[model samples]
Target: MCNTVKVSPRKLDPEIRTALVDIAARLLAEHGAQALSTRKIAAEAGTSTMAVYTYFGSMSGLVRAMVHEGFARLERQFARVRQTDDPVADMLVLGHAYRHNAKANSHLYAVMFGGQSLAGFSLTEEDRQYGRYTLLTVVGCVTRCIEAGRFRTGDPLLIAHQMWIATHGLVNLELGGYLIDPVDADRCYDTLLSSLIVGVGDDTKASAASMRASRRRRRREVEAEPESVAHRS
Candidate 1:
Protein backbone atom coordinates (compact mmCIF):
# COMPACT_ATOMS: atom_id res chain seq x y z
CA MET A 1 0.00 0.00 0.00
CA CYS A 2 1.16 3.54 -0.74
CA ASN A 3 0.22 6.97 0.56
CA THR A 4 -0.67 9.50 -2.15
CA VAL A 5 -1.23 13.20 -2.69
CA LYS A 6 -4.01 15.18 -4.28
CA VAL A 7 -3.94 16.48 -7.90
CA SER A 8 -2.06 13.44 -9.16
CA PRO A 9 -1.62 13.60 -12.93
CA ARG A 10 -3.87 10.63 -13.56
CA LYS A 11 -6.72 12.01 -11.48
CA LEU A 12 -6.73 15.55 -12.76
CA ASP A 13 -8.96 16.83 -15.55
CA PRO A 14 -7.04 16.40 -18.81
CA GLU A 15 -7.25 20.11 -19.51
CA ILE A 16 -5.89 21.13 -16.11
CA ARG A 17 -3.44 18.29 -15.36
CA THR A 18 -0.48 20.08 -16.89
CA ALA A 19 -1.13 23.16 -14.75
CA LEU A 20 -1.53 20.95 -11.70
CA VAL A 21 1.82 19.27 -12.30
CA ASP A 22 3.56 22.57 -12.86
CA ILE A 23 2.17 23.90 -9.60
CA ALA A 24 3.28 20.79 -7.72
CA ALA A 25 6.81 20.91 -9.19
CA ARG A 26 7.16 24.54 -8.16
CA LEU A 27 5.73 23.86 -4.71
CA LEU A 28 8.09 20.94 -4.19
CA ALA A 29 11.01 23.20 -5.06
CA GLU A 30 9.91 26.15 -2.94
CA HIS A 31 8.22 24.51 0.04
CA GLY A 32 9.22 20.82 0.19
CA ALA A 33 6.90 17.80 0.20
CA GLN A 34 5.06 18.55 3.43
CA ALA A 35 3.55 21.64 1.86
CA LEU A 36 1.99 19.61 -1.01
CA SER A 37 -1.46 19.31 0.48
CA THR A 38 -4.74 19.68 -1.42
CA ARG A 39 -5.50 22.85 0.52
CA LYS A 40 -2.26 24.46 -0.63
CA ILE A 41 -2.44 23.12 -4.17
CA ALA A 42 -6.04 24.14 -4.71
CA ALA A 43 -5.42 27.56 -3.23
CA GLU A 44 -2.43 28.10 -5.46
CA ALA A 45 -4.26 26.78 -8.52
CA GLY A 46 -7.21 29.06 -7.81
CA THR A 47 -9.53 26.11 -7.31
CA SER A 48 -11.51 24.60 -4.45
CA THR A 49 -10.09 21.70 -2.41
CA MET A 50 -12.91 19.53 -3.73
CA ALA A 51 -11.62 20.13 -7.23
CA VAL A 52 -8.24 18.73 -6.31
CA TYR A 53 -9.84 15.58 -4.92
CA THR A 54 -11.98 15.29 -8.03
CA TYR A 55 -8.80 15.40 -10.07
CA PHE A 56 -6.26 13.41 -8.04
CA GLY A 57 -8.42 11.15 -5.84
CA SER A 58 -6.04 11.47 -2.87
CA MET A 59 -2.76 12.91 -1.68
CA SER A 60 -0.95 9.62 -2.27
CA GLY A 61 -1.98 9.84 -5.90
CA LEU A 62 -0.37 13.24 -6.29
CA VAL A 63 2.95 12.08 -4.82
CA ARG A 64 3.16 9.20 -7.27
CA ALA A 65 2.40 11.63 -10.04
CA MET A 66 5.17 13.95 -8.91
CA VAL A 67 7.76 11.19 -8.65
CA HIS A 68 6.99 9.97 -12.14
CA GLU A 69 7.07 13.51 -13.48
CA GLY A 70 10.49 14.11 -11.93
CA PHE A 71 11.90 11.04 -13.63
CA ALA A 72 10.41 12.09 -16.94
CA ARG A 73 12.22 15.43 -16.76
CA LEU A 74 15.46 13.64 -15.95
CA GLU A 75 15.02 11.45 -19.01
CA ARG A 76 14.64 14.51 -21.19
CA GLN A 77 17.97 15.87 -20.00
CA PHE A 78 19.85 12.76 -21.07
CA ALA A 79 17.99 12.62 -24.33
CA ARG A 80 19.53 15.94 -25.29
CA VAL A 81 23.09 14.55 -25.12
CA ARG A 82 24.43 13.60 -28.51
CA GLN A 83 25.55 9.98 -28.56
CA THR A 84 29.04 10.63 -29.84
CA ASP A 85 30.81 7.86 -31.70
CA ASP A 86 33.64 8.34 -29.20
CA PRO A 87 32.59 6.64 -25.98
CA VAL A 88 35.01 8.44 -23.65
CA ALA A 89 33.79 11.80 -24.87
CA ASP A 90 30.21 10.66 -24.35
CA MET A 91 31.00 9.50 -20.81
CA LEU A 92 32.28 12.98 -20.04
CA VAL A 93 29.09 14.45 -21.42
CA LEU A 94 27.03 12.12 -19.23
CA GLY A 95 29.07 13.23 -16.22
CA HIS A 96 28.32 16.84 -17.00
CA ALA A 97 24.57 16.21 -17.23
CA TYR A 98 24.57 14.32 -13.91
CA ARG A 99 26.09 17.22 -11.98
CA HIS A 100 24.11 19.88 -13.79
CA ASN A 101 20.69 18.32 -13.21
CA ALA A 102 21.30 17.66 -9.51
CA LYS A 103 22.53 21.20 -8.88
CA ALA A 104 19.63 22.73 -10.80
CA ASN A 105 17.19 21.12 -8.36
CA SER A 106 19.01 20.37 -5.14
CA HIS A 107 15.95 20.29 -2.92
CA LEU A 108 14.04 17.92 -5.16
CA TYR A 109 17.12 15.76 -5.55
CA ALA A 110 17.43 15.58 -1.77
CA VAL A 111 13.80 14.54 -1.35
CA MET A 112 14.03 11.99 -4.16
CA PHE A 113 17.14 10.33 -2.76
CA GLY A 114 16.69 11.19 0.95
CA GLY A 115 13.11 9.89 1.26
CA GLN A 116 11.79 12.61 3.61
CA SER A 117 8.14 11.74 3.40
CA LEU A 118 6.07 11.09 6.55
CA ALA A 119 4.07 8.38 4.80
CA GLY A 120 6.19 6.00 2.80
CA PHE A 121 5.24 4.97 -0.73
CA SER A 122 6.11 1.87 -2.67
CA LEU A 123 6.51 2.57 -6.38
CA THR A 124 4.92 0.23 -8.82
CA GLU A 125 7.14 -1.20 -11.55
CA GLU A 126 5.82 1.38 -13.98
CA ASP A 127 6.72 4.27 -11.62
CA ARG A 128 10.11 2.90 -10.56
CA GLN A 129 11.08 2.18 -14.18
CA TYR A 130 11.05 5.91 -14.91
CA GLY A 131 14.26 7.90 -15.59
CA ARG A 132 16.43 4.77 -15.40
CA TYR A 133 17.28 5.19 -19.05
CA THR A 134 19.55 8.12 -18.18
CA LEU A 135 21.90 6.00 -16.04
CA LEU A 136 21.84 3.08 -18.44
CA THR A 137 22.69 5.42 -21.26
CA VAL A 138 25.84 6.32 -19.33
CA VAL A 139 26.50 2.66 -18.64
CA GLY A 140 26.05 1.91 -22.31
CA CYS A 141 28.51 4.62 -23.28
CA VAL A 142 30.96 3.35 -20.67
CA THR A 143 30.53 -0.12 -22.09
CA ARG A 144 31.51 1.26 -25.46
CA CYS A 145 34.59 3.01 -24.04
CA ILE A 146 35.55 -0.19 -22.27
CA GLU A 147 35.18 -2.03 -25.56
CA ALA A 148 37.25 0.70 -27.23
CA GLY A 149 40.04 0.29 -24.60
CA ARG A 150 39.55 3.88 -23.34
CA PHE A 151 38.35 3.24 -19.76
CA ARG A 152 39.11 0.62 -17.08
CA THR A 153 37.41 -2.76 -17.20
CA GLY A 154 35.05 -3.68 -14.37
CA ASP A 155 31.38 -4.35 -13.64
CA PRO A 156 29.48 -1.73 -15.65
CA LEU A 157 27.44 -0.79 -12.60
CA LEU A 158 30.63 -0.50 -10.53
CA ILE A 159 32.10 1.79 -13.13
CA ALA A 160 28.85 3.71 -13.27
CA HIS A 161 28.97 4.09 -9.45
CA GLN A 162 32.48 5.50 -9.63
CA MET A 163 31.35 8.06 -12.18
CA TRP A 164 28.36 8.81 -9.97
CA ILE A 165 30.49 9.32 -6.86
CA ALA A 166 32.85 11.67 -8.65
CA THR A 167 30.12 13.62 -10.37
CA HIS A 168 27.87 13.75 -7.29
CA GLY A 169 30.78 15.39 -5.45
CA LEU A 170 30.33 18.45 -7.64
CA VAL A 171 26.87 19.05 -6.17
CA ASN A 172 27.96 18.15 -2.65
CA LEU A 173 30.79 20.68 -2.71
CA GLU A 174 28.71 23.34 -4.41
CA LEU A 175 26.08 22.93 -1.69
CA GLY A 176 28.82 23.29 0.95
CA GLY A 177 30.02 26.56 -0.61
CA TYR A 178 33.26 25.09 -1.92
CA LEU A 179 33.05 26.90 -5.26
CA ILE A 180 32.67 30.46 -3.86
CA ASP A 181 36.16 31.63 -4.87
CA PRO A 182 38.73 30.88 -7.56
CA VAL A 183 37.50 27.44 -8.59
CA ASP A 184 35.20 27.17 -11.56
CA ALA A 185 33.27 23.95 -10.86
CA ASP A 186 32.98 22.78 -14.47
CA ARG A 187 36.70 23.32 -15.11
CA CYS A 188 37.71 21.54 -11.91
CA TYR A 189 35.55 18.54 -12.70
CA ASP A 190 36.86 18.18 -16.27
CA THR A 191 40.47 18.54 -15.13
CA LEU A 192 40.05 16.20 -12.16
CA LEU A 193 38.48 13.46 -14.30
CA SER A 194 41.08 13.86 -17.05
CA SER A 195 43.81 13.37 -14.49
CA LEU A 196 41.99 10.33 -13.14
CA ILE A 197 41.59 8.81 -16.61
CA VAL A 198 45.27 9.36 -17.27
CA GLY A 199 46.26 7.86 -13.93
CA VAL A 200 44.00 4.78 -14.14
CA GLY A 201 46.60 3.00 -16.28
CA ASP A 202 50.37 2.53 -15.78
CA ASP A 203 53.89 3.52 -17.00
CA THR A 204 54.01 0.30 -19.03
CA LYS A 205 51.33 1.74 -21.28
CA ALA A 206 53.11 2.49 -24.51
CA SER A 207 51.04 5.49 -25.58
CA ALA A 208 47.49 6.99 -25.51
CA ALA A 209 46.58 4.78 -28.45
CA SER A 210 47.81 1.62 -26.71
CA MET A 211 46.02 2.54 -23.45
CA ARG A 212 42.80 3.05 -25.36
CA ALA A 213 43.19 -0.35 -26.97
CA SER A 214 43.78 -1.87 -23.54
CA ARG A 215 40.58 -0.29 -22.27
CA ARG A 216 38.67 -1.71 -25.22
CA ARG A 217 40.08 -5.15 -24.51
CA ARG A 218 39.00 -4.96 -20.90
CA ARG A 219 35.48 -3.80 -21.72
CA ARG A 220 35.21 -6.71 -24.11
CA GLU A 221 35.86 -8.99 -21.11
CA VAL A 222 33.26 -7.44 -18.75
CA GLU A 223 29.59 -8.44 -18.75
CA ALA A 224 26.73 -6.09 -19.64
CA GLU A 225 24.04 -5.06 -17.13
CA PRO A 226 20.44 -6.21 -17.36
CA GLU A 227 18.14 -3.98 -19.39
CA SER A 228 16.44 -2.77 -16.21
CA VAL A 229 19.30 -0.36 -15.42
CA ALA A 230 17.08 2.45 -16.73
CA HIS A 231 15.25 2.93 -13.39
CA ARG A 232 16.65 5.90 -11.42
CA SER A 233 15.82 5.19 -7.78
Candidate 2:
Protein backbone atom coordinates (compact mmCIF):
# COMPACT_ATOMS: atom_id res chain seq x y z
CA MET A 1 0.00 0.00 0.00
CA CYS A 2 1.17 3.52 -0.78
CA ASN A 3 1.26 6.05 1.98
CA THR A 4 0.18 9.65 1.49
CA VAL A 5 1.27 12.57 3.64
CA LYS A 6 -1.15 15.31 4.45
CA VAL A 7 0.04 18.86 4.88
CA SER A 8 -1.95 21.53 6.63
CA PRO A 9 -2.01 25.12 5.37
CA ARG A 10 -1.78 26.28 8.98
CA LYS A 11 1.58 24.54 9.34
CA LEU A 12 3.08 25.86 6.09
CA ASP A 13 4.98 29.11 5.96
CA PRO A 14 3.74 31.87 3.68
CA GLU A 15 6.93 31.55 1.68
CA ILE A 16 6.15 27.93 0.96
CA ARG A 17 2.72 28.85 -0.33
CA THR A 18 4.24 31.53 -2.56
CA ALA A 19 6.81 29.01 -3.77
CA LEU A 20 4.10 26.56 -4.75
CA VAL A 21 2.32 29.27 -6.76
CA ASP A 22 5.55 30.30 -8.45
CA ILE A 23 6.34 26.73 -9.40
CA ALA A 24 2.84 26.23 -10.73
CA ALA A 25 3.13 29.44 -12.79
CA ARG A 26 6.41 28.28 -14.34
CA LEU A 27 4.92 24.88 -15.13
CA LEU A 28 1.92 26.49 -16.77
CA ALA A 29 4.19 28.67 -18.85
CA GLU A 30 6.60 25.95 -19.94
CA HIS A 31 4.17 23.06 -20.39
CA GLY A 32 0.81 24.74 -21.01
CA ALA A 33 -2.32 24.60 -18.88
CA GLN A 34 -3.27 20.99 -19.66
CA ALA A 35 0.00 19.76 -18.18
CA LEU A 36 -0.68 21.24 -14.75
CA SER A 37 -1.39 18.72 -12.01
CA THR A 38 -1.21 18.66 -8.21
CA ARG A 39 1.35 15.86 -8.21
CA LYS A 40 3.60 17.64 -10.68
CA ILE A 41 3.35 20.94 -8.84
CA ALA A 42 4.04 19.20 -5.51
CA ALA A 43 7.13 17.49 -6.88
CA GLU A 44 8.41 20.70 -8.35
CA ALA A 45 7.69 22.60 -5.14
CA GLY A 46 9.30 19.84 -3.07
CA THR A 47 6.19 19.49 -0.97
CA SER A 48 3.40 16.96 -0.49
CA THR A 49 0.51 16.98 -2.95
CA MET A 50 -1.71 17.94 -0.08
CA ALA A 51 0.10 21.24 0.03
CA VAL A 52 -1.86 22.32 -3.04
CA TYR A 53 -5.15 21.45 -1.41
CA THR A 54 -4.07 22.98 1.87
CA TYR A 55 -2.98 26.26 0.40
CA PHE A 56 -5.42 26.65 -2.45
CA GLY A 57 -8.13 24.09 -1.76
CA SER A 58 -8.29 22.85 -5.37
CA MET A 59 -7.04 23.46 -8.89
CA SER A 60 -9.52 26.29 -9.33
CA GLY A 61 -8.20 27.85 -6.18
CA LEU A 62 -4.68 27.61 -7.53
CA VAL A 63 -5.78 29.29 -10.75
CA ARG A 64 -7.31 32.10 -8.76
CA ALA A 65 -4.04 32.56 -6.91
CA MET A 66 -2.19 32.76 -10.21
CA VAL A 67 -4.55 35.45 -11.45
CA HIS A 68 -4.06 37.47 -8.30
CA GLU A 69 -0.30 37.03 -8.44
CA GLY A 70 -0.20 38.23 -12.03
CA PHE A 71 -2.07 41.44 -11.18
CA ALA A 72 -0.02 42.04 -8.05
CA ARG A 73 3.21 41.81 -10.04
CA LEU A 74 1.80 44.13 -12.70
CA GLU A 75 0.78 46.62 -10.04
CA ARG A 76 4.29 46.63 -8.61
CA GLN A 77 5.80 47.29 -12.03
CA PHE A 78 3.39 50.17 -12.73
CA ALA A 79 4.00 51.61 -9.29
CA ARG A 80 7.69 51.85 -10.10
CA VAL A 81 7.02 54.21 -13.02
CA ARG A 82 7.72 57.78 -11.98
CA GLN A 83 5.11 60.45 -12.56
CA THR A 84 6.20 63.57 -14.40
CA ASP A 85 4.67 66.92 -15.36
CA ASP A 86 4.31 65.55 -18.89
CA PRO A 87 1.39 63.25 -18.32
CA VAL A 88 1.42 61.89 -21.86
CA ALA A 89 5.07 61.02 -21.57
CA ASP A 90 4.43 59.56 -18.12
CA MET A 91 1.60 57.46 -19.52
CA LEU A 92 3.88 56.20 -22.27
CA VAL A 93 6.43 55.22 -19.66
CA LEU A 94 3.74 53.28 -17.83
CA GLY A 95 2.77 51.58 -21.10
CA HIS A 96 6.33 50.47 -21.66
CA ALA A 97 6.46 49.14 -18.12
CA TYR A 98 3.25 47.24 -18.75
CA ARG A 99 4.75 45.52 -21.79
CA HIS A 100 7.96 44.77 -19.90
CA ASN A 101 6.07 43.16 -17.05
CA ALA A 102 4.01 41.01 -19.41
CA LYS A 103 7.09 39.87 -21.32
CA ALA A 104 8.96 39.01 -18.15
CA ASN A 105 6.07 36.90 -16.89
CA SER A 106 4.60 35.47 -20.09
CA HIS A 107 3.20 32.39 -18.38
CA LEU A 108 1.48 34.36 -15.69
CA TYR A 109 0.26 36.79 -18.35
CA ALA A 110 -1.24 33.90 -20.25
CA VAL A 111 -2.97 32.53 -17.20
CA MET A 112 -4.40 35.94 -16.52
CA PHE A 113 -5.66 36.69 -20.04
CA GLY A 114 -5.86 33.42 -21.89
CA GLY A 115 -9.41 32.20 -21.49
CA GLN A 116 -8.57 28.56 -22.05
CA SER A 117 -5.36 28.57 -20.02
CA LEU A 118 -7.13 27.83 -16.74
CA ALA A 119 -9.16 24.98 -18.24
CA GLY A 120 -11.88 24.27 -15.70
CA PHE A 121 -11.21 27.33 -13.60
CA SER A 122 -13.31 30.48 -14.00
CA LEU A 123 -12.24 33.80 -12.62
CA THR A 124 -14.40 35.02 -9.79
CA GLU A 125 -15.50 38.65 -9.48
CA GLU A 126 -12.77 39.27 -6.94
CA ASP A 127 -10.14 37.94 -9.32
CA ARG A 128 -11.48 40.29 -12.00
CA GLN A 129 -11.53 43.24 -9.58
CA TYR A 130 -7.83 42.76 -8.98
CA GLY A 131 -7.24 43.07 -12.73
CA ARG A 132 -9.48 46.12 -12.95
CA TYR A 133 -7.53 47.81 -10.20
CA THR A 134 -4.32 47.36 -12.14
CA LEU A 135 -5.92 49.00 -15.18
CA LEU A 136 -7.13 51.79 -12.95
CA THR A 137 -3.50 52.76 -12.51
CA VAL A 138 -3.33 53.51 -16.21
CA VAL A 139 -6.67 55.24 -16.06
CA GLY A 140 -5.27 57.49 -13.40
CA CYS A 141 -2.38 58.39 -15.66
CA VAL A 142 -4.79 59.15 -18.48
CA THR A 143 -6.79 61.34 -16.16
CA ARG A 144 -3.63 63.24 -15.39
CA CYS A 145 -3.07 63.73 -19.12
CA ILE A 146 -6.57 65.11 -19.50
CA GLU A 147 -6.11 67.43 -16.56
CA ALA A 148 -2.82 68.66 -18.02
CA GLY A 149 -4.65 69.63 -21.22
CA ARG A 150 -2.73 66.96 -23.15
CA PHE A 151 -5.54 64.57 -23.87
CA ARG A 152 -8.89 65.69 -25.31
CA THR A 153 -11.70 66.40 -22.94
CA GLY A 154 -13.64 63.16 -22.57
CA ASP A 155 -14.11 60.18 -20.31
CA PRO A 156 -10.67 59.10 -19.13
CA LEU A 157 -11.78 55.57 -18.53
CA LEU A 158 -12.92 55.07 -22.13
CA ILE A 159 -9.69 56.52 -23.48
CA ALA A 160 -7.64 54.38 -21.15
CA HIS A 161 -9.58 51.27 -22.15
CA GLN A 162 -8.85 51.92 -25.81
CA MET A 163 -5.18 52.35 -25.08
CA TRP A 164 -5.16 49.20 -23.00
CA ILE A 165 -6.74 47.17 -25.79
CA ALA A 166 -4.13 48.36 -28.24
CA THR A 167 -1.20 47.74 -25.92
CA HIS A 168 -2.55 44.37 -24.79
CA GLY A 169 -2.93 43.23 -28.38
CA LEU A 170 0.67 44.11 -29.12
CA VAL A 171 1.97 42.36 -26.01
CA ASN A 172 -0.09 39.26 -26.75
CA LEU A 173 1.24 39.07 -30.27
CA GLU A 174 4.83 39.46 -29.13
CA LEU A 175 4.44 36.84 -26.39
CA GLY A 176 2.81 34.42 -28.82
CA GLY A 177 5.96 34.64 -30.99
CA TYR A 178 4.07 36.42 -33.73
CA LEU A 179 6.63 39.23 -33.71
CA ILE A 180 9.95 37.64 -34.65
CA ASP A 181 12.03 40.82 -34.73
CA PRO A 182 12.08 42.49 -31.35
CA VAL A 183 13.44 45.74 -32.73
CA ASP A 184 10.66 46.01 -35.26
CA ALA A 185 8.10 45.13 -32.61
CA ASP A 186 9.47 47.81 -30.32
CA ARG A 187 9.38 50.36 -33.09
CA CYS A 188 5.80 49.39 -33.82
CA TYR A 189 4.88 49.74 -30.18
CA ASP A 190 6.37 53.23 -30.03
CA THR A 191 4.55 54.23 -33.19
CA LEU A 192 1.31 52.82 -31.82
CA LEU A 193 1.74 54.67 -28.55
CA SER A 194 2.60 57.89 -30.34
CA SER A 195 -0.44 57.53 -32.54
CA LEU A 196 -2.70 56.90 -29.57
CA ILE A 197 -1.38 59.96 -27.80
CA VAL A 198 -1.81 62.06 -30.91
CA GLY A 199 -5.35 60.82 -31.35
CA VAL A 200 -6.08 62.11 -27.90
CA GLY A 201 -5.13 65.64 -29.10
CA ASP A 202 -1.55 65.64 -27.93
CA ASP A 203 1.46 66.95 -29.84
CA THR A 204 3.23 63.61 -29.91
CA LYS A 205 4.77 64.16 -33.36
CA ALA A 206 7.33 66.60 -32.00
CA SER A 207 8.01 64.24 -29.11
CA ALA A 208 8.45 61.30 -31.47
CA ALA A 209 10.73 63.31 -33.75
CA SER A 210 12.77 64.48 -30.80
CA MET A 211 13.12 60.90 -29.58
CA ARG A 212 14.35 59.76 -33.00
CA ALA A 213 16.81 62.63 -33.13
CA SER A 214 18.07 61.74 -29.67
CA ARG A 215 18.57 58.13 -30.67
CA ARG A 216 20.48 59.18 -33.77
CA ARG A 217 22.66 61.53 -31.75
CA ARG A 218 23.39 58.80 -29.20
CA ARG A 219 24.29 56.37 -31.95
CA ARG A 220 26.65 58.94 -33.54
CA GLU A 221 28.26 59.61 -30.17
CA VAL A 222 28.85 55.91 -29.67
CA GLU A 223 30.21 55.48 -33.18
CA ALA A 224 32.48 58.52 -32.76
CA GLU A 225 34.10 57.02 -29.66
CA PRO A 226 37.59 55.66 -30.41
CA GLU A 227 37.71 51.87 -30.43
CA SER A 228 40.49 51.96 -27.81
CA VAL A 229 38.43 54.25 -25.56
CA ALA A 230 35.33 52.06 -25.97
CA HIS A 231 37.30 48.95 -25.11
CA ARG A 232 38.85 50.60 -22.04
CA SER A 233 35.43 51.79 -20.72
Best by lDDT: 2
Instruction: Give the alpha carbon lDDT tens digit for every residue of 18-73 in model 1.
Output: 45555665677677667777777766666667765566566666666666656655
Write the residue-wise lDDT of candidate 2 on 175-219 in tens digits.
Answer: 878887545986887788888888887876655753454344333
TM-score of 2: 0.82
Q: Model 1: how far is 26 from its true place, Å?
A: 3.1
Worst lDDT run of 10 residues, candidate 1, spans 217-226
lDDT of 2 at 230: 18
Q: Model 1, stretches more than 4 Å misplaced?
A: 1-15, 105-107, 116-128, 175-180, 199-233
Residue pair clashes in candidate 2: none
Query: Candidates' TM-scores?
Result: 0.67, 0.82
The C-alpha lDDT values of all candidates are: 0.57, 0.74
lDDT for predicted candidate 2 compared with the true structure = 0.74
Question: Which runs of model 2 end up more than 4 angstroms from their true locations?
Answer: 1-10, 115-119, 180-183, 209-233
- What TM-score does prediction 1 earn? 0.67
